[model samples]
Target: MDDPIMKHNVPDTEWFDRSSLRRMLRTYSLVYIKPDVGRKGNGIIRVKRLRAEEFEISYKQTTSLRSRDKVYSAIKELLNPDKEYIIQQGIDLATYRHRPFDVRVVLQKPLGKWRTTLMCAKLAPRRSSVVTNVSKGAKDYNLYRLLKGTDQRLNRSEIIRNLIDVSKQIAQILGSHFPLKILGLDMGIDKRGNIWFIEANTKPDCQGLKKIDRRLYRKYLRAKKIMRNG
Candidate 1:
């Protein structure tokens, strides 16, 4: 988020704490709190402002609280004190048939140059689900279908092109600092078709990607082989 160009797509994020949580809730109706070293959407929390004082929070289950202190206490109780957390202003994700989803773009360094290897839509199993993580019961769908056929308000081609470019740029930026060979970026599309940078996984799971696109999955395997044995 330090990059001026990248920060625009990145949501407003802050270290999870009472002050930051209260301040973000004042500006945005929804926010997400997650462990600093978490994956599979485990230990993630969703907070929504229902009224001036009343708030709705969802973790393992949904609950309502009347005060910021109460909300803080409730969330804190669910968190592991040994781990760190961050609060990010949530994106009102684009939905298909009322289920929210996000695009997962994987970029790999094949022969030492960054290129997008695969892209797929991870759809939440149900309407009320918080995270669209497959390990958390989400399903993968064809990205083109979700962006083009289901929704017309968004320019599907443009969104894909932009994210592809952004993903490559991100690989370049972060690769400069770390010896990274691959990056799995979680990109979100809001109800208005605007793209958002949700988060990135250094070691992304590509287990079921072949179910989305065989050719792309093969391309990913080739890249992995080249990077591993080159």
Candidate 2:
């Protein structure tokens, strides 16, 4: 949100509250609320404004339609009141076999220069999942094949190149502010092939890369070794 150059790729995001909620819902038809320090897609809430005075909120497997006045209460019921949350505009994620997915870009700064070492994706196991989180039962897919094979109409090559460029730029920009050696960025692409910034992970969990692609997984391990030695 701070960088002007990369901010444009980010979805509308703000602190989660009654005011921000009402204001954001008024501006955008869809919004998602997530824990500030959450992981594996837990404690996330999806809210959609169907029409005036009618709202829909979905969490995990349960979904409910609430009136305009009761929307907040419904969302609050699913939240752990102790934790802080962020409300963000939801993206119409590209789907594969009816399941939505998101891209994961691994950038490592070995001996000072930043480079994207690995690119993969996590596909949600079911259509109802609020997130495409691997730890929470999502399946890993080869980013290249997933983008190229399924979306026949899109320019997959261009999207891949753009993802690399945008991800590297984000790494460089964020690296300047934090003393981080590795970053796992969660990136999103809509059906129209436009890329969006989701989140940046300082301690990215890329442990099981072998399942997606053996070669890229080996490269990821090598990058980790180099970053560790330095």
Please provide, for model 1 over 60-104, each residue's C-alpha lDDT reduced to its tens digit, 9 standing for 90 to 100: 556556576688888888899999999999999988888899999
As a TM-score, model 1 comes out at 0.95
Q: Could you give candidate 2's per-residue lDDT for residues 86-132 as a string of tens digits?
A: 99999988888778889999999888988888889889998778888
Q: TM-score of each candidate?
A: 0.95, 0.95
Residue 64 lDDT, candidate 1, scale 0-100:
57
The ten-residue window of minimal lDDT in model 2 covers 147-156
Give the C-alpha lDDT of model 1. 0.89
Query: lDDT of each model, Cα atoms only?
Result: 0.89, 0.88
Name the TM-score of candidate 2: 0.95
Q: How close to the true structure is residue 148 of candidate 1, measured as C-alpha lDDT?
A: 67
